[model samples]
Target: MRTTKLPTIELSLVTLRSIQKKDFKDFFEFGKDKETTEFLTWGPFKTLKDAKTMLKYIYFKRQQRNEPIGYAIVSKETSKMIGTIEYHTFNHKGNSCEIGYVLHKDYWKKGIMTEALQKVTQIGFEVLDLDKLVIKHLRENIGSKKVILKNGYKLVAIYEKQHFHTKTGQYHDVFVYEHWKK
Candidate 1:
Protein backbone atom coordinates (compact mmCIF):
# COMPACT_ATOMS: atom_id res chain seq x y z
CA MET A 1 0.00 0.00 0.00
CA ARG A 2 1.09 3.55 -0.62
CA THR A 3 1.78 5.33 2.66
CA THR A 4 0.27 8.77 3.15
CA LYS A 5 1.28 11.93 4.96
CA LEU A 6 -1.66 14.31 5.25
CA PRO A 7 -1.21 17.91 4.20
CA THR A 8 -3.05 20.95 5.50
CA ILE A 9 -5.92 21.61 3.07
CA GLU A 10 -7.28 25.13 3.14
CA LEU A 11 -10.80 25.72 1.90
CA SER A 12 -12.92 28.84 2.10
CA LEU A 13 -14.55 27.85 5.38
CA VAL A 14 -12.38 25.07 6.80
CA THR A 15 -8.85 23.73 6.91
CA LEU A 16 -8.06 20.03 6.72
CA ARG A 17 -5.06 19.26 8.85
CA SER A 18 -3.51 16.49 10.89
CA ILE A 19 -4.98 15.53 14.24
CA GLN A 20 -3.10 16.98 17.16
CA LYS A 21 -3.28 16.15 20.87
CA LYS A 22 -4.59 19.57 21.85
CA ASP A 23 -7.53 19.29 19.45
CA PHE A 24 -9.27 16.83 21.73
CA LYS A 25 -11.20 19.67 23.31
CA ASP A 26 -12.52 20.77 19.93
CA PHE A 27 -13.58 17.24 19.08
CA PHE A 28 -15.33 16.97 22.40
CA GLU A 29 -17.34 20.06 21.57
CA PHE A 30 -19.82 18.24 19.33
CA GLY A 31 -18.65 14.66 19.89
CA LYS A 32 -20.60 14.55 23.13
CA ASP A 33 -23.86 15.10 21.33
CA LYS A 34 -25.92 12.02 20.46
CA GLU A 35 -27.80 13.86 17.75
CA THR A 36 -24.58 14.79 16.02
CA THR A 37 -23.42 11.18 15.91
CA GLU A 38 -26.89 9.81 15.24
CA PHE A 39 -26.12 8.45 11.76
CA LEU A 40 -22.46 7.52 12.24
CA THR A 41 -20.70 4.41 13.37
CA TRP A 42 -18.84 5.88 16.35
CA GLY A 43 -18.79 8.54 19.06
CA PRO A 44 -20.93 10.55 21.44
CA PHE A 45 -17.93 10.68 23.70
CA LYS A 46 -18.85 10.90 27.38
CA THR A 47 -15.47 12.06 28.60
CA LEU A 48 -12.22 13.63 27.52
CA LYS A 49 -10.57 10.24 27.89
CA ASP A 50 -12.70 8.85 25.11
CA ALA A 51 -11.76 11.67 22.79
CA LYS A 52 -8.13 11.39 23.80
CA THR A 53 -7.94 7.67 23.02
CA MET A 54 -9.56 8.11 19.62
CA LEU A 55 -7.26 11.00 18.80
CA LYS A 56 -4.23 8.97 19.78
CA TYR A 57 -5.22 6.24 17.33
CA ILE A 58 -5.87 8.72 14.55
CA TYR A 59 -2.69 10.65 15.27
CA PHE A 60 -0.31 7.77 15.92
CA LYS A 61 -1.33 4.20 15.28
CA ARG A 62 -2.66 4.56 11.76
CA GLN A 63 0.63 6.06 10.64
CA GLN A 64 2.62 3.19 12.09
CA ARG A 65 0.46 0.69 10.24
CA ASN A 66 0.72 2.57 6.92
CA GLU A 67 -3.03 2.74 6.74
CA PRO A 68 -4.73 5.31 4.56
CA ILE A 69 -5.09 8.28 6.89
CA GLY A 70 -7.23 11.41 6.76
CA TYR A 71 -7.45 15.05 7.75
CA ALA A 72 -9.17 16.74 10.67
CA ILE A 73 -11.57 19.37 9.38
CA VAL A 74 -10.80 22.52 11.34
CA SER A 75 -12.90 25.60 10.88
CA LYS A 76 -10.98 28.65 9.66
CA GLU A 77 -13.55 31.01 11.18
CA THR A 78 -13.45 29.46 14.64
CA SER A 79 -10.05 27.73 14.39
CA LYS A 80 -11.48 24.57 15.90
CA MET A 81 -11.78 21.00 14.73
CA ILE A 82 -15.44 20.57 13.99
CA GLY A 83 -15.18 17.27 12.07
CA THR A 84 -13.04 15.03 9.84
CA ILE A 85 -12.75 13.78 6.25
CA GLU A 86 -10.60 10.85 5.27
CA TYR A 87 -9.76 8.04 2.89
CA HIS A 88 -10.30 4.72 4.65
CA THR A 89 -10.51 0.98 3.96
CA PHE A 90 -8.12 1.31 1.11
CA ASN A 91 -7.96 -1.10 -1.82
CA HIS A 92 -4.58 -0.32 -3.25
CA LYS A 93 -4.58 -3.18 -5.72
CA GLY A 94 -7.71 -1.76 -7.32
CA ASN A 95 -6.60 1.86 -7.16
CA SER A 96 -9.74 2.88 -5.34
CA CYS A 97 -10.63 3.78 -1.76
CA GLU A 98 -13.56 4.95 0.29
CA ILE A 99 -14.07 8.51 1.51
CA GLY A 100 -15.93 9.38 4.69
CA TYR A 101 -16.66 12.50 6.71
CA VAL A 102 -18.51 13.89 9.71
CA LEU A 103 -19.24 17.51 10.60
CA HIS A 104 -20.26 19.18 13.83
CA LYS A 105 -24.01 19.48 14.00
CA ASP A 106 -23.72 23.23 14.50
CA TYR A 107 -22.19 23.58 11.04
CA TRP A 108 -24.64 21.39 9.17
CA LYS A 109 -26.62 22.54 6.07
CA LYS A 110 -23.85 24.89 5.02
CA GLY A 111 -21.56 24.26 1.99
CA ILE A 112 -18.46 23.57 4.08
CA MET A 113 -18.28 19.81 3.55
CA THR A 114 -19.10 20.15 -0.12
CA GLU A 115 -16.18 22.51 -0.64
CA ALA A 116 -13.85 20.36 1.38
CA LEU A 117 -14.79 17.23 -0.54
CA GLN A 118 -14.14 18.95 -3.85
CA LYS A 119 -10.53 19.67 -2.92
CA VAL A 120 -10.06 16.24 -1.43
CA THR A 121 -11.35 14.80 -4.66
CA GLN A 122 -8.70 16.76 -6.54
CA ILE A 123 -6.02 15.46 -4.21
CA GLY A 124 -7.31 11.93 -4.48
CA PHE A 125 -7.31 11.98 -8.24
CA GLU A 126 -4.29 14.14 -8.94
CA VAL A 127 -1.93 14.09 -5.95
CA LEU A 128 -2.53 10.44 -5.16
CA ASP A 129 -3.05 9.64 -8.84
CA LEU A 130 -5.77 7.20 -8.02
CA ASP A 131 -8.20 5.92 -10.67
CA LYS A 132 -11.37 6.66 -8.72
CA LEU A 133 -12.93 7.34 -5.33
CA VAL A 134 -15.70 5.57 -3.50
CA ILE A 135 -18.17 6.81 -0.89
CA LYS A 136 -21.11 5.39 1.01
CA HIS A 137 -23.89 6.73 3.19
CA LEU A 138 -26.81 5.26 5.06
CA ARG A 139 -30.13 5.31 3.22
CA GLU A 140 -31.77 7.65 5.72
CA ASN A 141 -28.95 10.16 5.77
CA ILE A 142 -30.36 12.68 3.34
CA GLY A 143 -27.69 15.17 4.34
CA SER A 144 -24.90 12.78 3.46
CA LYS A 145 -26.63 11.84 0.22
CA LYS A 146 -26.72 15.48 -0.76
CA VAL A 147 -23.03 15.93 -0.06
CA ILE A 148 -22.13 12.86 -2.10
CA LEU A 149 -24.20 14.04 -5.04
CA LYS A 150 -22.85 17.55 -4.81
CA ASN A 151 -19.33 16.17 -5.02
CA GLY A 152 -20.22 14.40 -8.30
CA TYR A 153 -20.41 10.82 -7.11
CA LYS A 154 -22.89 8.58 -8.91
CA LEU A 155 -24.98 5.75 -7.52
CA VAL A 156 -23.20 2.50 -8.29
CA ALA A 157 -24.83 0.01 -6.00
CA ILE A 158 -27.13 -0.57 -3.04
CA TYR A 159 -27.10 -3.31 -0.50
CA GLU A 160 -29.85 -4.34 1.86
CA LYS A 161 -28.98 -3.67 5.50
CA GLN A 162 -25.32 -3.21 4.64
CA HIS A 163 -24.35 -1.50 7.84
CA PHE A 164 -25.69 -1.92 11.35
CA HIS A 165 -25.75 1.68 12.51
CA THR A 166 -24.76 1.49 16.13
CA LYS A 167 -25.76 5.10 16.65
CA THR A 168 -29.36 4.50 15.64
CA GLY A 169 -29.51 0.95 16.98
CA GLN A 170 -30.65 -0.62 13.73
CA TYR A 171 -29.57 -1.96 10.39
CA HIS A 172 -29.71 0.45 7.48
CA ASP A 173 -29.45 0.03 3.74
CA VAL A 174 -26.41 1.69 2.21
CA PHE A 175 -25.88 3.58 -0.99
CA VAL A 176 -22.52 3.17 -2.66
CA TYR A 177 -21.35 5.94 -4.94
CA GLU A 178 -18.26 6.29 -7.11
CA HIS A 179 -16.51 9.15 -8.89
CA TRP A 180 -13.87 8.17 -11.38
CA LYS A 181 -10.91 10.32 -12.26
CA LYS A 182 -11.90 12.80 -14.94
Candidate 2:
Protein backbone atom coordinates (compact mmCIF):
# COMPACT_ATOMS: atom_id res chain seq x y z
CA MET A 1 0.00 0.00 0.00
CA ARG A 2 1.22 3.49 -0.78
CA THR A 3 1.07 5.26 2.58
CA THR A 4 1.61 8.77 1.36
CA LYS A 5 0.80 12.22 2.70
CA LEU A 6 -2.77 13.44 3.16
CA PRO A 7 -2.72 15.02 -0.26
CA THR A 8 -2.22 11.63 -1.88
CA ILE A 9 -5.64 10.41 -0.66
CA GLU A 10 -7.41 13.75 -0.97
CA LEU A 11 -10.46 13.69 -3.27
CA SER A 12 -10.70 16.22 -6.04
CA LEU A 13 -13.48 18.79 -5.74
CA VAL A 14 -12.72 21.78 -7.87
CA THR A 15 -10.07 23.64 -5.79
CA LEU A 16 -10.47 22.72 -2.16
CA ARG A 17 -8.46 20.50 0.15
CA SER A 18 -9.94 17.35 1.68
CA ILE A 19 -10.78 19.06 4.95
CA GLN A 20 -9.80 22.48 6.24
CA LYS A 21 -10.32 24.73 9.23
CA LYS A 22 -11.46 27.51 6.94
CA ASP A 23 -14.32 25.32 5.81
CA PHE A 24 -15.82 25.39 9.32
CA LYS A 25 -18.18 28.27 8.63
CA ASP A 26 -19.70 26.58 5.62
CA PHE A 27 -19.86 23.28 7.44
CA PHE A 28 -21.56 24.96 10.34
CA GLU A 29 -24.08 26.61 8.11
CA PHE A 30 -24.94 23.41 6.30
CA GLY A 31 -25.04 21.30 9.43
CA LYS A 32 -27.31 23.67 11.24
CA ASP A 33 -29.95 23.54 8.59
CA LYS A 34 -32.83 21.38 9.88
CA GLU A 35 -33.17 19.53 6.61
CA THR A 36 -29.50 18.68 6.67
CA THR A 37 -29.19 17.84 10.35
CA GLU A 38 -32.33 15.74 10.55
CA PHE A 39 -30.62 12.46 9.76
CA LEU A 40 -27.27 13.26 11.28
CA THR A 41 -26.16 11.89 14.61
CA TRP A 42 -24.90 15.24 15.81
CA GLY A 43 -26.42 18.65 15.99
CA PRO A 44 -28.32 21.74 15.08
CA PHE A 45 -25.38 23.93 16.03
CA LYS A 46 -26.44 26.67 18.38
CA THR A 47 -23.54 28.80 17.22
CA LEU A 48 -20.61 28.90 14.84
CA LYS A 49 -18.23 29.01 17.75
CA ASP A 50 -19.69 25.72 18.88
CA ALA A 51 -19.01 24.38 15.43
CA LYS A 52 -15.43 25.60 15.63
CA THR A 53 -15.00 23.74 18.87
CA MET A 54 -16.29 20.63 17.19
CA LEU A 55 -13.89 21.22 14.31
CA LYS A 56 -11.06 21.34 16.78
CA TYR A 57 -12.12 17.98 18.08
CA ILE A 58 -12.23 16.60 14.57
CA TYR A 59 -8.74 17.85 13.88
CA PHE A 60 -7.49 16.27 17.05
CA LYS A 61 -8.83 12.90 15.95
CA ARG A 62 -7.21 13.27 12.54
CA GLN A 63 -3.86 14.02 14.17
CA GLN A 64 -4.10 10.99 16.39
CA ARG A 65 -5.00 8.58 13.61
CA ASN A 66 -2.50 10.01 11.14
CA GLU A 67 -5.10 9.33 8.49
CA PRO A 68 -7.56 11.30 6.47
CA ILE A 69 -10.30 11.48 9.08
CA GLY A 70 -12.84 12.83 6.62
CA TYR A 71 -13.32 14.90 3.48
CA ALA A 72 -15.37 17.98 2.97
CA ILE A 73 -17.32 17.30 -0.20
CA VAL A 74 -16.78 20.49 -2.13
CA SER A 75 -18.08 22.14 -5.27
CA LYS A 76 -15.74 23.02 -8.08
CA GLU A 77 -17.86 25.80 -9.48
CA THR A 78 -18.25 27.72 -6.23
CA SER A 79 -15.33 26.23 -4.25
CA LYS A 80 -17.48 25.61 -1.23
CA MET A 81 -17.90 22.73 1.18
CA ILE A 82 -21.21 21.07 0.40
CA GLY A 83 -21.02 18.07 2.67
CA THR A 84 -18.75 15.46 4.24
CA ILE A 85 -18.06 11.72 4.13
CA GLU A 86 -15.96 9.83 6.64
CA TYR A 87 -14.79 6.49 8.00
CA HIS A 88 -14.46 6.24 11.72
CA THR A 89 -14.83 2.80 13.25
CA PHE A 90 -12.04 0.90 11.57
CA ASN A 91 -10.98 -2.65 12.25
CA HIS A 92 -7.58 -2.70 10.60
CA LYS A 93 -6.90 -6.41 10.63
CA GLY A 94 -10.40 -7.15 9.50
CA ASN A 95 -9.87 -4.72 6.64
CA SER A 96 -13.20 -3.19 7.50
CA CYS A 97 -14.62 0.18 8.46
CA GLU A 98 -17.87 2.00 9.11
CA ILE A 99 -18.78 4.89 6.85
CA GLY A 100 -20.88 7.99 7.39
CA TYR A 101 -21.90 10.89 5.21
CA VAL A 102 -24.09 13.98 5.06
CA LEU A 103 -24.70 16.80 2.61
CA HIS A 104 -26.41 20.14 2.66
CA LYS A 105 -30.06 19.57 1.80
CA ASP A 106 -29.72 21.77 -1.27
CA TYR A 107 -27.14 19.42 -2.69
CA TRP A 108 -29.22 16.29 -2.25
CA LYS A 109 -30.30 14.28 -5.29
CA LYS A 110 -27.47 15.82 -7.30
CA GLY A 111 -25.44 12.59 -7.23
CA ILE A 112 -22.67 14.47 -5.44
CA MET A 113 -22.47 11.83 -2.73
CA THR A 114 -22.55 8.96 -5.19
CA GLU A 115 -19.51 10.37 -6.96
CA ALA A 116 -17.71 11.11 -3.73
CA LEU A 117 -18.36 7.68 -2.25
CA GLN A 118 -17.20 5.99 -5.44
CA LYS A 119 -13.88 7.78 -5.18
CA VAL A 120 -13.55 7.26 -1.45
CA THR A 121 -14.43 3.58 -1.62
CA GLN A 122 -11.85 3.15 -4.35
CA ILE A 123 -9.28 4.65 -2.07
CA GLY A 124 -10.38 2.51 0.86
CA PHE A 125 -9.99 -0.59 -1.27
CA GLU A 126 -7.16 0.16 -3.71
CA VAL A 127 -5.06 2.38 -1.52
CA LEU A 128 -5.98 1.57 2.05
CA ASP A 129 -6.47 -2.13 1.34
CA LEU A 130 -9.73 -2.34 3.19
CA ASP A 131 -11.71 -5.44 2.25
CA LYS A 132 -15.07 -4.34 3.57
CA LEU A 133 -17.02 -1.14 4.14
CA VAL A 134 -20.30 -0.78 5.99
CA ILE A 135 -22.89 1.97 5.94
CA LYS A 136 -26.02 2.45 8.01
CA HIS A 137 -29.01 4.69 7.65
CA LEU A 138 -32.24 5.31 9.46
CA ARG A 139 -34.91 3.19 7.79
CA GLU A 140 -37.06 6.24 7.29
CA ASN A 141 -34.27 8.04 5.52
CA ILE A 142 -35.13 6.79 2.07
CA GLY A 143 -32.69 9.14 0.43
CA SER A 144 -29.74 7.90 2.45
CA LYS A 145 -30.69 4.28 1.93
CA LYS A 146 -30.83 5.00 -1.80
CA VAL A 147 -27.38 6.49 -1.71
CA ILE A 148 -25.98 3.38 -0.06
CA LEU A 149 -27.66 1.07 -2.54
CA LYS A 150 -26.66 3.26 -5.46
CA ASN A 151 -23.07 3.06 -4.30
CA GLY A 152 -23.23 -0.75 -4.56
CA TYR A 153 -23.41 -1.56 -0.89
CA LYS A 154 -25.56 -4.58 -0.18
CA LEU A 155 -28.16 -4.91 2.51
CA VAL A 156 -26.64 -6.89 5.36
CA ALA A 157 -28.50 -6.14 8.56
CA ILE A 158 -31.25 -4.11 10.09
CA TYR A 159 -31.03 -2.87 13.65
CA GLU A 160 -34.48 -2.91 15.17
CA LYS A 161 -35.25 0.46 16.62
CA GLN A 162 -31.58 1.20 16.93
CA HIS A 163 -31.37 4.73 15.67
CA PHE A 164 -31.85 7.52 18.15
CA HIS A 165 -33.69 10.47 16.70
CA THR A 166 -31.46 13.47 17.24
CA LYS A 167 -34.39 15.84 17.27
CA THR A 168 -37.32 13.85 18.51
CA GLY A 169 -35.45 11.82 21.10
CA GLN A 170 -37.08 8.68 19.83
CA TYR A 171 -35.53 5.42 18.73
CA HIS A 172 -36.05 4.13 15.22
CA ASP A 173 -35.08 1.21 13.08
CA VAL A 174 -31.93 1.44 10.98
CA PHE A 175 -30.70 -0.48 7.99
CA VAL A 176 -27.09 -1.54 7.86
CA TYR A 177 -25.40 -2.21 4.56
CA GLU A 178 -22.01 -3.57 3.62
CA HIS A 179 -19.74 -3.77 0.58
CA TRP A 180 -16.68 -5.88 0.05
CA LYS A 181 -13.92 -5.31 -2.48
CA LYS A 182 -13.01 -8.91 -3.10
Q: Pick the candidate with the highest lDDT.
A: 1
lDDT of 1 by residue, 1-182 (tens): 33476668888788888777788898888788897887777788999988888878764576775764578898888898999888777687898888888899899988988998998888888777788899998898899999989989999999998898766677889999999998
Candidate 2 global CA lDDT score: 0.76
TM-scores, in order shown? 0.92, 0.89
Q: Tally clashing residue pairs in candidate 2.
A: 0
lDDT of 2 by residue, 1-182 (tens): 23413343344443224677888898898978877988777877888987788777964466576555577777777778888777767776786888888888887887777777777777778776778998988888898887788889999889898877868889999898999997
| lDDT, model 1, position 6 | 62
Model 2 residue 6 CA deviation in Å:
4.7
The TM-score obtained by model 1 is 0.92
Candidate 2 error regions (>4 Å)? 1-16
When summed lDDT is taken over every stretch of 10 residues in candidate 1, the lowest stretch is 59-68
Candidate 1: deviation at residue 126, Å? 1.3
After superposition, candidate 1 runs with Cα above 4 Å error: 1-3
Error of 1 at 7 (Å): 2.7
